[model samples]
Structure formats: C-alpha cells, structure tokens
Target: MEPKTISTARTARYISLGEPGADIQHVFFCLHGESQALADFAAQLVNFDTPERLLVLPEALSRYTMPAGPAGAPLTVASWFAADSLLPDLADLTAYLDELAAEVLAHCPAGVPVTVLGYGSGAAAACRWLAGGRTHYDRLLLYAPVFPPSIDRRATLVGLPDRPITLISTTTEAFTTEAVGAGLLQDLQDVGLSAQHRYVSEGPLTLAALGTVGK
Candidate 1:
C-alpha cells in the first residue's frame, strides 16, 4: 500500500474590523500566536479599531490540546503547524492566506497602504509565506519572530530586502532574549535586509500598544 495526498478546500477562520465604507486609510493583516484563540486575540486588538484603519485576524487552521497544562483537564487551542508535518501543511496554508489577503484587498480602494503583523509562532508562518517573494504588502511587522532552525536563510531572504520590517522585542521574554534577538537582526543584515529593532518597556506579547506600524 502507498500513502496518499489530497487537495481540498478548508475553512479559513478570520475576523475583521473597520469595514469598507469607513475612512479606511490602512489595511492590516495580523496572525495570532500559538495556542491563542482567534476571537480572544482579535478582541485585544480592538483599540486599533478606527475610522482610518482596517484590521484582519486570520485564525490558525490546526487545533490541538495544549501541552504543559496545570495537570488537570487539557485546554484546546490552535497552532499554525505541527513539527511532524510542516512544509506540506504550510503549502496549503500559504495558498489560502494569499487568496484571503487578495480578497481583503479587493474591497479596498487603490494605493492604500498594507501592513502584515504576526506575533511569536504566527510571525514564523507569515515570514515563511513571504519568503517566496510574493510581495503582498508594503511592510511586515514581526513581534519576536521565531524562524525554524531548518530554514535556509538563502531562500527565505530572497527578494525581501526591499520590504520594511520592524522587529519588536520586549525588555524581558526568553524567546526574545538578547542573544536570540541580536542574532535574528544580524541574520537579516547578512541577507541585505536591515530591520529596525524596538524594545518595549516590559510585558507579554501584544500588538495593540505598538501603534500603526509602517505609517
């Protein structure tokens, strides 16, 4: 017997604010982090809700029982990929995200600025998709981006130098420690892409306080 592969459509869960009729000056694409729920994560960003801005939150396609729980009933959450199977999963995801983004753009007027922001694991997914030279947006905002160690910088870094990327990190967060954060910036520089690094006062990962990036 042989394994099989299937191609089909899957529901891409998402939420949006500041519809087409308002004075929308900017369109934002935000990817929620691992174990984060779409509705809850989107709720925190409601402050970005304004007449001049439109925000989109695309939910992760995969869900699982979270690990390292408090030794009781497990909690359910979503994630972008599973290490056991990533590339193939993301291939399907990137296609869906591209289509979704295109549809979002279709409703907006011409020449409106676009920004894509992702937190933690979400940042990794967004970067992986953009790595293929799609040029979907004017700017990319990554808060503590976590790229897989297996990622080939040569391929991922191609055609991205032109995109303005702001890498935000906090004063404290193991994932965004000095060494890891510095290395990421250095890696970008090595590939001819210079990133702006900003350190927030101190807190958990959140995009609401960052204000409108790429403005």
Candidate 2:
C-alpha cells in the first residue's frame, strides 16, 4: 500500500498518581515500552503515590496486538510510534508531545521539577522529542533504551542547556546494556551534553526495578 498522511483524533489517556490538590513537589512523565500499556506500567509505580510526588502515564497512540503461540491468549498493548512511519509520523509526534508536555505543566504548580522517563521503545521516542527541541524537563531518563543508531546527538540536544541526560539500563536487556548504554551516554557527552548511564540491577529491566524516582 502507498503511504499518505492524515490527521485523526483519539482519546489521549493519561493515568495519574497522587492527588491533584495535594502539595505535589515533583511530577514525572513516564512512557512505557513496546507492547506495554500505560495502565500496566503505571500500576508498578505505586511508590510514587504520595503528596510529594505525582506520576503521569501517557498512553501510546498506536496499539499492537501480540501474537499468541504456546501462550493461551493474545496480548494487546501500545507503542509510541511505528518504525515504518518515521518521517511524517515523527514530525506529528514532535508536535503532539510538545503540546502534551505544555498541557501537563500548565496544570502543575509552577517551578515543579519535571522528569520524563521512557522505557525501551518509549525511550526512543523520548530521545526523539528531546532531539527535536520540542520541550524542556529537569531530567530525561531512558531505561533499556532502543533507539536508531544513526541519531545525531548534537541535533538531539539542540538548544538545551547542559544537564544530566540519564540512560538507565540493565545487564540482560536486549538492546541497551551496562556497557552499550554507556556508549550512548558517551556519545551524548561527546556532543557537548551532560549524560550519565546508570543501572538499576544486573537483570532484566522492569517497572518494579525502578522505585520511587528522585534527583
């Protein structure tokens, strides 16, 4: 099939933890990996449920249904974007993500530190958003990151002041590992970025592995 671009609207679901009227100190924007839903991922972050910290989970625009093999039932989840539609799709995503961040911050208390966390595929989208110079956050964390290798680091950190760009990965994750994820950090630093690579543990990357986040 030929490719074309069209605009459509779907319900954007954002699951939040912590009360809105409470004295929220920090707000986190967390994105899930491929074949993962916001609801499932957000559930793992129950530790963030407090008056001090607020967590927001944004659902991916695309839903993917996993094939069932020996497993009894098929699984359905979401992905940030499709690799096949990077060109125009990324442009659209850049705008949408920028708007989403702005909208979220608007309702938040002024000067609250904002952190954007993305896991795997979601990490890739997080990097893209940063590279496109869409919005600003206090911290950008990528867990078990899986992003295009050819991405330009200089372009990715454009116009942003030097800050810690953290890459959080595990030992057994398919893509970003303890060693390889460091290379990503180095590349970012080479391009005049302040980057850090951290590991939560020596096993697979899971939501439970990341406890309540802090600076």
Candidate 3:
C-alpha cells in the first residue's frame, strides 16, 4: 500500500507504510532519537516482510540542522521531543501525542494492537504517552530511553499494570549503561508495569531485534 503522510501541530510530519486498511493487526510507533527523522526508522521497518505489521514514524516537531557547519553537508532533523532539554512536562507531551494519535486513528482501523518504541528522549515521550492514557497501546518498547528527572517513578506506576511492557537496552551504548538500564528496569517493576529488560551488544538497531522484543 502507498504510504500516507500527516502534518502535526508541532509542525512535524509522520509517515506510514502499508495500506491503512490492510488488515492491520499491529501498529508500531517508532519515535526517532535526536537529530534523526522518521525516515531513519522507516528504512529498517521496510526490510520486514510481515504483511500484518504497520509501521508509523512521527517526526519530531523541532528541527536542528547538522552541526557539521558546511553548506548542505548533511541536514539532520529530529522531532521536537527528541532533544535533551530539562525535565519534560507530561501534560504538554500528552497534548502532542493526543493530536498525533488522532491523525493516526483517522487513517487506521480501531482496536489494532499498538506498540510504542522510543529511542533516547523519544523513549521518554513514549513513556509519557503511555502514562497519559491518551492511547490504548498493547505494548510499549523502550530502546535506550531517558526518563525525566522530575518524573515520579512511583506516581507513574499507579496506572501501569504488570507484563504489558518491555524495555530493551544495549550494553555497549553509553546511553543505556548497565547501571542506568538496571535502574529503569527496577523502577518499572516497582511500578508494576510487567517489564522485561534485555541487554544487547553494541550495534545498529534492526527490525529483527525489535521483532524479537515484540514477540
């Protein structure tokens, strides 16, 4: 199916692969990291052959050109929420996700299993999205996510049930260090989110790895 695009209030864009009506049983929301576009993750999902899987990539609202400081050296852009700014306000993010989710649901069917995957700050956005109860996603996949310092780990745990989420981290990546990753795992568990943390070797993220966790 031809891919469709949507414009968000943050002035960002989102891309989708597979027909909106292709019997979508599962939806994958891939939130890109800093300085990355939705297409960055879309390329990986294109490698998969699963007809039932639909991938949606939403670009961050904020745009930051590549810092190489050369004319058109290589433009790098990211979503507004991908930056390492101070602690994020959950309410603001929820509003953004609410708008984006509405656009997504407009083109897709209802009751499809939703999976949210966030890399870096995008992970934190995903967490906030889940916590806000704006969308009914079945699974949340966090890849090297950074949690907000202001986030009350205990408070966030109130509504999350056990075994509905999975956290994926890398051992070699500086962002997902063993200590930090372990802390996140413990926090999720304490909140009764039913999370499983995995330690992968340093390497590129792939659909195969994501599919493993989705299973």
Candidate 4:
C-alpha cells in the first residue's frame, strides 16, 4: 500500500524533578538516547539534581518496542524523530519543545539559566531543536553528539557567540575519538561560537565527571 500521513493531537509525557517555588536556580531540558525511557534516563542524572535545580526530561515523540529473543521480555523505548518524515518531524519537534519550554519557564523565577542537554541520538534532536531558535537557553551540552548537515548552516544562529556549547563523551565510547569530538568543537569555533569537547570516565555521566560544565 502507498504511504499516507495525518496529524493528530496526543499527549507527550515528561518528568520534572525538584520542587518548583522560590529559590530555583537552574532549569535543565534533557533529551534521552534512542530506545531510552524518560524516567530511566533521569535516574542516571540524579547526581546532577539539587534543591535549587529543576530537571525536565522530555521523551521523544516516537515510541517503539525493541525486538527481543524468545525468552527476553519486550522492551519499549522512544526516539526523538524518524528519518522517514524528517522535515515535518523536525518542525513538529520544535513546536512541541517550544511549548514545553514556555510552560516550564512560566513557573520558573526570572533570570534562571536554562541548560539543554542531549545524549547520543538525542544530541542531534537537541541541536536541531535549538537551531530553530524558538527557545532560549543559557548553555548547550551534547553527550555523544552526532550532528546533521543542517546544523552547519544554523550553528551561528543558536547564540553561539554568547552561549557556551560543550561536546561531552566518555573515554570508552568508540565514537568519542579525538577526531570526531574535536572536529565538531573546531567546526563550531570556526564560526565564532564558544565550544569545547570534554571527556569523562568510561561510564554513565555523573556530577563529578561533569564538574564545572555550565558553570
């Protein structure tokens, strides 16, 4: 059958950590890797949590069940977007993120810094969403980032001259080679953007590993 498409309203779930009230210092917008759940991903970043910080974990719009062996239990996961409908999906993603950001920021105290962190596949999504220039953030952190060609043209537009961007990865990941991470940082810097590549230990991210980032 020939493929067809349509739009419909749906509920997208996100997790908000830390209490909202006075004394809030920072707000984080985090995106997870492919096949990752919002809650599970947030658990890994608990080290980054604090009384003055609010963590917002937004799951990708697409959900799927990963294939499993005969005895393996079914696993459900989410992705930021699908290649089959990239352009439209990207537009939709930016709109959704804009709404999410606005909703969260409405309750936040004025002058609170916002940090956008994307991991693995979510890195591309985060970059694209920020590229749209719809939301305001104080910093960009990409963990195991993979960039698309479009980001090259829009790099300077994401407040690169003023905002800091960091490419983060662990030492053990094969993709975190000096050539790959440094090349990305260099590319951003070439356009007059403040960018850097930081390496942590070969494991899940922790506050100690990410010391001084977004500071």
Root-mean-square deviation of every model: 3.3, 3.6, 7.4, 3.0
Candidate 4 residues lying further than 4 Å off, grouped into runs, are 1-4, 68-73, 148-161, 174-180, 211-215
Per-residue lDDT of candidate 2, residues 90-148 (tens digit): 66667777787788777778888888887777777777776674577877777777665
Report the Cα lDDT for residue 105, model 3: 64
Looking at candidate 4, what is the lDDT of residue 41? 88
Can you give the TM-score per candidate against the true fold? 0.83, 0.80, 0.76, 0.84
- Candidate whose lDDT is highest: 4
Q: Which of the two candidates, 3 or 4, achieves a greater lDDT against the reference?
A: 4
Give the candidate order by descending TM-score.
Answer: 4, 1, 2, 3
Off by more than 4 A, model 2: 67-74, 149-154, 157-161, 173-180, 202-215
lDDT of 3 by residue, 93-157 (tens): 66766787777766777777777877777777676667665577777777877655545555665
> After best superposition, candidate 3 residue 154: deviation in angstroms?
4.2
How many pairs of residues collide in each model?
0, 1, 6, 0
Model 3 alpha-carbon drift over 4 Å, by segment? 1-9, 44-49, 69-72, 79-89, 157-163, 174-180, 204-215
lDDT of 4 by residue, 1-215 (tens): 97787888768878889856668888889998878867668877887788888989887888888887599776778977676677777877888889999988888898788889988777878877887747889888878776554444345234343677777876675653532576667667666777767777645577655556535
Q: Which of candidates 1 and 2 is the stronger one according to TM-score?
A: 1
Among all candidates shown, the one with the greatest TM-score:
4
Off by over 4 Å in 1: 1-3, 65-76, 133-135, 159-161, 174-180, 202-215
